[model samples]
Target: MLDWLTSAALHAFGAPTTWAELLGFASGLLCVYLVVRQHIANWPIGIANNLLLMVAFWHVGLFGDAWLQVVYVGLGAYGWWRWGTGRVEQRVRSTTRAEWWWLAIAGVLLTVALWWYLDRWTESTVPGPDALTTAVSLLATYGQTRRLVESWWLWIAVDVVYVPLYGYKDLWLTALLYLVFLALCVLGLRAWREQLRTAPQGSPAWSMD
Candidate 1:
């Protein structure tokens, strides 16, 4: 598994091109679009994006990120189903501002644990940054699935860290893509906030603004 994954990364990193970068770029745009629009289709599209990124990052030996995409595939599917079922959104469970502190603490603890294990026990090169991104992303994905309205904040924080990390790794295209994602996170937050405000508590469907 290591040999195959490593070889793929080497091949991709060796020849990073406009087309490969654009695939990532376009997917990022579509994801943010669907997210801001509150469309259930976003998850399936997100799954596709993750699969593309899995190959792209794997070829570059960003093992943590590469593997992260694989996990996202599952999460994306779960998110899609959760949204489709209309349970969480119907609940309209907005977290208190205090919950943000809890999410921060959780993000920090998870990042520390992953960084330590991946760096110390494994042969991960950028484990600290990689694990941190993955941890924040986990929270964001969970929040998103549950329609908790806090997901965008988590994504904003993650995107800030990701821009520099991807740039340092010479994933210039991805770095640029994240800039767009940062903006989208802000938009998504506002959009979802409006969604929650007008939506009747315990109602299932959101009206388009």
Candidate 2:
């Protein structure tokens, strides 16, 4: 089974797709799907997906993304704790206008900072774009943990950037996965909007200072 899973027959766009990539792809997809449905299970499954992709990205010398995956592990744990209450459906909340402003500010700053770090400290080729997406993804993950509908919007932006980035690395399978992620982000946004209409409504105003 292991050999079959890793066989060259599992190829995409003329590139071999390893069993690990396939596992990460499926796990990542499922996690996003669950997130869209407002399920708490996405956290653990996303961790699994991130771990698998961490190995894949590191092997390809995308150290920024590899490290991002490791960071995602702890973040996912925090998200799990934040969103996975006994009455989980009740705890889900949306981001406020003020939070969006702060998140955007931080996203830009972190992107610039990470770009500089990756360019100077690492061997990353697409440092600018990689840093941008990675930074936004961090904020997006936090937004999703808080059940913010705008998280899906941020994910849409990140997926658009990630597809070509992965393709440039010849990770065609992962690139295609991001395309699916783009679609899912749209659906998640719509679903979460409807959810906000009925689930629970509260201000997400928290100090960013």
Candidate 3:
């Protein structure tokens, strides 16, 4: 696998060899940074990261992840528009705890659907886990695009599984990226909670009835 990640194989990344990966690497970092700041700019940066990663994953033959980037592209664009057009201020809803029943139902449905589709239809060797992670990630991204604070917890859940999955696939750098994402989720959660606390009395960030 080391051979697979060597400077030679990555010559497509250009003279620095790691340029493409670094573009992906840095954009991932920036996306997390912007999200932590609660800046709407995170969406564009997130879109950039997704596009870069789509290239990276396709090269590595992680087609599932490559397809996921496509979804992120669409979601990121929507998030950018929604946030930038003052729609966020108009619709900035407070986070509520997801009900235990709904959480259970979603979990079971996602797991089963991923397992069934991947195991039965895809040529992917790791399809079951890959599909499961992708499904949860889709849900998390959907929540994040809407600025739902609970999205971080969903990310946390997926990251825990994804780190091991990437490691198993010998994607050390990608695994490292997910590790940073996990930490950022924790930071983002704390930051957003504080924002909730300090929001104006009638602001949407506040949980007014």
Candidate 4:
């Protein structure tokens, strides 16, 4: 079963596309489409996408990204529960100044730390970009769980870097997937901003808590 899943499904961009990559691509596209529509089902679909991409990335020796997929599974579960809890205050909102500061600091620290670790201990040839994208992705996912509108901005940044990065790694299908994610992130940002604009006047649009 593992062999069959990992075997080449087809050729694309001169690279052999595996069944895992194909499945990951489909699920990932659906996950982001659901996210743009503000549907809660994106979380579960994202978890499945993570599992498929983990195998695809590992096969290509993108160890950092492969491990990132494991972390995504945990984050996806938290997001699933958070979105489904029916909390009145869990509406679309801007990130508070403090939250922005914290996320910026975390992004910098995580990128540096992951770069060092991946360069020194891992076989990743593109450790710098791999680490940077991984850190940004984690931050974006965390912000998404809180329903913060800025999460889409971070995703947009990551997707821009990811497209070329994956292509360089010969994972053409995954690179194309990020291209689609780039477009979806833009739509998601606009949709969430509209949600915030039309929210009740007294409701918080920016939350410090």
Candidate ranking under TM-score, highest first, comes to 4, 2, 1, 3
Q: Compared with the true structure, what per-residue lDDT tens digits does model 4 show for residues 94-175?
A: 9999999999999999999999999999999999999999999999999888889999999999999999999998899999
Best by lDDT: 4
Q: For model 2, how many clashes? A: 0
Lowest-sum lDDT 10-residue window in model 2: 200-209
Candidate 3 regions exceeding 4 Å error are 1-19, 89-111, 202-209
Which tens-of-lDDT digit does each residue in 35-148 have in candidate 3?
777677788889888877777666655667778899999988987777667566533345555643565568679768766776776666787777778778887887777777
lDDT (Cα, 0-100) at 179 in candidate 3: 94
* lDDT, residue 131, candidate 1: 95
TM-scores vs. true structure, each candidate: 0.82, 0.87, 0.79, 0.94
CA shift at 96, candidate 4, in angstroms?
0.5
- Could you say which candidate leads in TM-score? 4
Clash totals, every prediction: 3, 0, 0, 0
Candidate 1 lDDT, 1-209, residue by residue in tens: 43332232322345454444556678878987987777777888888788777766766657778788888899898988777776455544577778778888998898898888778876677898899999889889878887788788889999999998887777777887899899999988888888778877666554334
- The positional error of residue 50 in candidate 4, measured at the CA in angstroms, is 0.2
Q: Residue by residue across 124-148, what tens digits does model 2's lDDT show? A: 9989988998898899988876767
Which stretches of candidate 4 lie above 4 Å from their native place? 201-209
